[model samples]
Target chain A: MPAPAIQVDNLSKLYHIGASEQYHTFREAIIEVASAPLRRLRNFGRASSSDSNIIWALKDATFAVQPGEVVGVIGRNGSGKSTLLKILSRITEPTEGRAHMRGRVGSLLEVGTGFHPELTGRENIYLSGAILGMKRTEINRKFDEIVDFSGVKKFIDTPVKRYSSGMKVRLGFAVAAHLDPEILLIDEVLAVGDAEFQNKCLGKMDDVAKSGRTVLFVSHNMGAITDLCPRALLLTRGSLQADGSTPDVVSEYLSVATPDGYVDLRHWKSERSGDGPMRIEAVEILDSKGARAGQIQAGEPIRFRLSVRGKSGAKCNLSVAIRDMMERIIYNPNTSDDKATVTLPAERAIVEVSLQENRLARGDYSASVWLGDAMNVTNDRVHHCLKFRIEDSSLGQTRSKGLVRTNGQWSVQRRGL
Target chain B: MNPQSNQFTSAMTADESAPAAPSEDIPELIIEAQKGWIPIHFGDLWRYRELLYFLTWRDVKIRYKQTVFGFLWAFIQPFLKMIVFSVIFGGLAQMDSEGFPYPIFVFAGLLPWQFFSESLSRSSNSVVGSSSLVTKVYFPRLVIPLGAVGGCLVDFAISFLVLVGLMAWYGIAPRVGILMVGPLVVLTVIASLGAGTLISALNVAYRDFRYVVPFMVQIWMFLTPVIYSVDIIPEDWQWLLMLNPMAGIVDGYRSAILGKPFDWSNIAISAAVALVLFFVGAVVFRRIERRFADII
Candidate 1:
């Protein structure tokens, strides 16, 4: 057999919490180094043991993908998915072990990563393409096609700052999608743009996968993963928990649970997009009786309690979406649907949404919460941050056929009596 | 360039053919944890030369984007500095210009000195300023500071025109030794890049370098013979001044442009010091670069 396109062997990365922490000034670094000797003497035993400030972001992750294989990496926030991709792309060095790639590699850790605002769209394409490791000739050859795909031809010469955010995302994804590398690593960049553009990106990615190049994709969107990848790897915490067919790996991922019935959104590390005057602090799932429950019957009432923390007198529109294991929205409840404006009285407040009856099919599900303003600007969003299970109704345990159970009333009427 | 084009063509062909096509032309990449003091990878730098070009181009383009004066600012800055120094040092202080007019002499020194200082300050902050690129994309980290330094060459070229005009006005003709200015300018770049790369890495590790760099650049200017001729220093102590790489560079520019006798010993010492700084800078940058994406 030909050599695998990518081979990762026991790759690990240890992050120092306080040592390389952000916002550290030179004076603090100097003082820390100066006091190192005395501090070490005082905590000699603790120093020799395990330092509390150190945490492994990735540990002993070993996997290999053959040429032309498309593999999806699925994980919760801080599950080392991005860390793994970062290491493979060589954005950040691994702390231990190594990885080998057989051919040229291109990674899209972020879209529009190096696009200078002052540059025109055409110039940004060249600049961003070069940043992503594309040769100038290659970009020249694909320039027309990229512009056509992005649908930003009218603004090609306009400065990028003038383009809408959606336009920017489309242009960015178009450039990345044209990168004809032997190996491609993508990290949740498809989570931007409108649905039509996202579909176009997925179609382009499909074409890329069909071209026989190896691909490693990371995304929180399970539906996209199932659509694009045949095989998948599941990461829990920092370890590779499962690697198998997409179905099995996704099921394994969905079954991984948070403690109790609440997820602490305050410190959760997920791909969050928004400027925040309002933030989601935590989310709690409750059954009909209002007690914390990890699983509810298909017909039982479910309530989502969202603890929002923000500035006093801030106004927001809160929305919650329940999605199935495939990441398809099974149910959506929005405060704006009732024309309700949620006003914050103080620093923290709990806003709860109750479903009178959960008609979701018997399967694993996750809740994504969103906070936005009247201007349609997303103030904060946490996607699929809360996971729970829905069981069959108490009458009989029958597997459902689709994403939701039909609750239509049955009325028999004879048309030709 | 030939090999790279060949690789690209082969990669394209491989993409079009069957998956199992036995083309062994594809290069293998191995990424391992870097230990202490990793050696510089000149090959990687060469391969990423296009990115260096684009980054430098981006800097130049964005620099004067909204400015009304645009590229004229490049000429105006050095010319204004020359006038101010000519009045303050040449007229008020009566500092010695050796032989040439004070404006021409000081302008000669200012040319290399301005390039050095501008490139140094920009490059020292380049890694921190491009934190988005550093943390997201993977290229030779050396390219960031190198591109910053490269971008300053445009301003230097523009300001060089002013110096040329001044020389013509003064009716001072350049000799064949004027070709030496090219090597001296290169030496200045080396010195600036060395210091820039070192400070940029430090800036990433300690943000306080944000305040330290400009202050350091101010102090560094006084130490170099920019406003005055090196002859002002005592004969024995003049050797000590050459230890500062910019001193020799400024002296070399004046010697080349003014057609003065070259100081071979001073130039030699300056070249040696510049090389040493470059070596140290590259080593430290490479050693610390592995952590840049993490810390930055």
Candidate 2:
């Protein structure tokens, strides 16, 4: 057999938590170096104590992917999925072990990573492409195709700052998608742009996978993962928990957690990205009678009480999405969808949302919250932060198959035979 | 069925016949923890030569994007400095110019001096300024500072025109010794890049190191013979002055243009120091570069 395209053996990375917080100054460094000998003498013969500031972001992760294999990396926040990708892409050095990659490797850790605001779209294409490791000749060959895919041909000569945020994201993804490497590593860059553009990107990725190149995809969207990747790896708290077929690994991930009726968002252990002027401090799942419940009956009405914290007179667009165990988003409810406006008071306030019917089948489900403006800026977001279960309806005990349950009236009339 | 699939199939068939050839064509990349005293990887830098060009282009393009004067500012900066120095040092102090006019002499010296100073300051802050690139992408860290220095070459070329205009005004044509100016300018770049790379690496770890740069450049100008001629110094102490790499470069430019006798000993000493500084700076930069993404 041909050699594996990527081989990772016992890779690990340790990060210092509080040590990074301290300000590093030349004066302090000089003093520390000057006093090193005295300090060593003072602590002579004493065993080195474990420093509390250190945490292993990744530990003993060993995996290999054969050529033409597509693998999905799925994990909750701070679970080492990104850390693993970063190490493989050589953005950060691993603390121990080694990784061998055969053939050309291109990583899209972030889109628009080196895009300059002052540069025109055409110039940024070349600049960002070069930064992403594409040669000039390769970029020249694919220039027209990249621009056509992005749909920003009209503004190709305009500065990037003039483009809308969605336009920028599309252009960024366009350049990255054109990278024809033997091995591709992608992070969650698909979680941008409108739904239609996201579909376009996913289609392009599907084409890339079909071309028989090795790929490692990391995303919080389980539906995308199940659709694109045949095999998957699951990480939990910096450790590889499971590696198997996509369905098995996803099921293993979903089964690892118990449903929660309430979650404290303030101290939630997740990687959140946003410029937060407003935040979702906490969330509570409530039944029809206003009591906390971890499991609700299908077809029953459900309510959510969100504790929001922000400055007074701050306007926010709040959206909550509910997904089933397969992590396919069933439905989303947004305040802006109803043309309703929300203004937060100083400190903290509770905003409640009520749904007429859960309309969900018997299965485990999760709810993710998002706080942002009417524009594309996400002030705060927590993915799959709250989880609950939808039990069978009281009338019947049959197991359900699909994601949603809809009630329909049936009518029949006798006709001439 | 489509062209894309047809290409894929053909490539797969070819690969099946020559499995070992592909590996031989593209070397495998092995990533592990870096050990002590990492040497500079000139091969990796060479492989990423295109990125260096693009980065340098970006810097030069964005520098004068909205400015009304554009490249004229490059000439204006050194010209203004030359006028002020000629008045103060040449007129007020009556310092000797070794036979050439003071404006021409100082202008010649300022041309290389400004290049060195500008390149040094820009490169010293380059890594910190491109924090986004450093943290998000992987390339040779040396390229950032090198690109910054390269961008200044355009400004230096533009400023060289002003020196020619000044020499024309004084009716002092350059002699055959002017050919040596090319090597002298290269020596100046080496010295600037050496100090710049060292400081830029340190600036990533200690942010306050940025403040030290302008102050250091100000003091460094005095130590070098930019505004004054080195002939005024006693012959014995001239060797001590040659320790500053720019002293020899500035002296070399004046002698090259003014047709004075060459100082081989001083130039040789300066070249030696410049090479040593480059070596030390690159060694230190490579050692600390592995932690840049984490800390930055």
Candidate 3:
């Protein structure tokens, strides 16, 4: 058990905000300052004090990163992702708890972050370098590398105010990339620069990671997160909701997501059994030998065992869906696939629904089981469905990720001439 | 001096020899990440002090950047106010300047007072103006206010040079008491830094503090003994007057530059008030600094 590269222990931050409550006259402000202690005592004497309003920006956040690991932090607005980064960078302190870091953290928090508008690009390079805890000699040694990397050789001496936002970002990132901080903490600011710059930064980050530096990256781009980081920490409203392999956590997050943090559990309840109308108890996604497995190779026969009890004598049909991590229905198998509906008797029974998984390729999949009775009608009154994860290795490489692996092939040729 | 240059993590080029993935590259910024008083390398601050000095210089340079009168404006400000007071308060109303000529007398007081006003106003707003830096980058917050105070020295020097010319014209040599002006000027710096820190903290939350600042400076001028001698205030009200720290500061300047002995009781009051202000201001500023990144 080696020491984690980044160790955060019960970290929290509090911010006191003044409401639009009272408008103090200048004299009142001075008088209040004069009597601060007395007013504080008076406020404390009350059951609750409005003046001491606190916003718990980050709460009991604890996690760590192993050396050279690239971790992504994902969340919506005001989820405390940025606040946590600021604390780790030592730009601010936590109200409680301690965060320990083992390396230098280079952050691209914002463009033109430390550049002086009046100073030339060259001057700002030195200034920003100093701000990142680098010395002049270190900057001098890497100056050429930075200039070349940023592609701002021509305007290196020009005052930064004259530079466009794109140029500012290019130079800013060049300096930061060349900063050689052992642990890189990058926010979404990279998305600000041009697409080319963004790609260049991605490549630079790849190189930084290859060179064995730790990186804690935050972005809303799920595609980018899956591609860049091997592991991820998902934040939701100032708490660590999940921390695990990229694919598993992302799938869980997607399933439980809402438009505005208002979670719609329609999909979540579908996969949960044992407390529904039919009294679905346990579900096992099995292989050919009735062996339970979390995954299988694409184009293989997958089995689903769902146990349920029928309280009334109603003919029931079984339906199960195979969806990817995003909950998109990749394949839905019905018990009527044999051209004959299998009717359920009025009693508690164990049932099995097996389907050929040949069409699916190598990727992660989920099983959604539903029990319903609607033999005479096209649609059925379905009960609850259970969720289970299944892996298919037939798509392509075992390492392939995302919605699923598609074995689609393409060929390019010139027109006959 | 990138202190970190020599502190890079141990490299395990061969995979078989590597410890793990993430911790392998963590930088050694903290003396001991897990424990003890993490000593701030003041030497590191010193190495980068040039940027600090330049920022201060930049603030001073930008102040007069688009203005027409340039450095002369620094001189004209206290000079004009000195003439106005010399006419209205000193000549017509016949106020005492310790028997010294009114222009020189008032100019001396105006000099320190102007420094305090300009320094305090700029320092209080320094944090808000540099919010981008505070939120986006990491540096000591104390540096911002210090730079503003440091920037005023340039203007102070320029303005002080004109005071020497005024003295030569009046043929009034600075007395032995002039030596005391050094400590008085220092008290002004400390006092201004104190007030600046406190007001800057408030400025972060209220934002109305920015608008209130100029008005505060105006009212503060009337409260200080810049226009009149402290001797004229009734003894009963003088105790209340001593509460304004700048009161004793300006009077000390008059006593210093005019060859009068120091006012012991008044100096003690000013010292007590200025120290208290600095202590309270530093604590308030430290308390507010935690949320600056979020709120700013």
Which model scores highest in TM-score?
1
* Candidate numbers sorted by lDDT from highest down: 1, 2, 3
Q: Any idea how many clashes model 1 has? A: 0
Worst 10 residues of 2 chain B by lDDT: B12-21
User: Could you give the CAPRI-style class of model 3?
Assistant: incorrect
Off by over 4 Å in 3: A12-59, A91-96, A104-106, A136-145, A222-228, A245-417, B1-51, B234-240
TM-score of each predicted structure versus truth: 0.83, 0.82, 0.66
lDDT by residue (tens digit), candidate 3, B249-278: 888888887667788788779878998998
Instruction: For each candidate in the order shown, give its overall lDDT on alpha carbons.
Output: 0.87, 0.86, 0.72
Residue A407 accuracy (lDDT) in model 2: 68
Query: How much is the lDDT of residue A77 in candidate 1?
Result: 71
For model 2, residues B133-201, the per-residue Cα lDDT tens digits are 887888899999999999998889888888788778888788999999889888988998998899899
Predicted model 2 interface RMSD: 2.2
The list of candidate 1 runs beyond 4 A from truth reads A46-50, A258-284, A289-300, A304-386, A389-417, B1-24
TM-score of candidate 2 versus the correct structure, residues matched by position = 0.82
Residue B59 deviation, candidate 1, in Å? 1.1
lDDT of 1 at B268: 88
Restricted to chain B, the TM-score per model reads 0.92, 0.91, 0.83
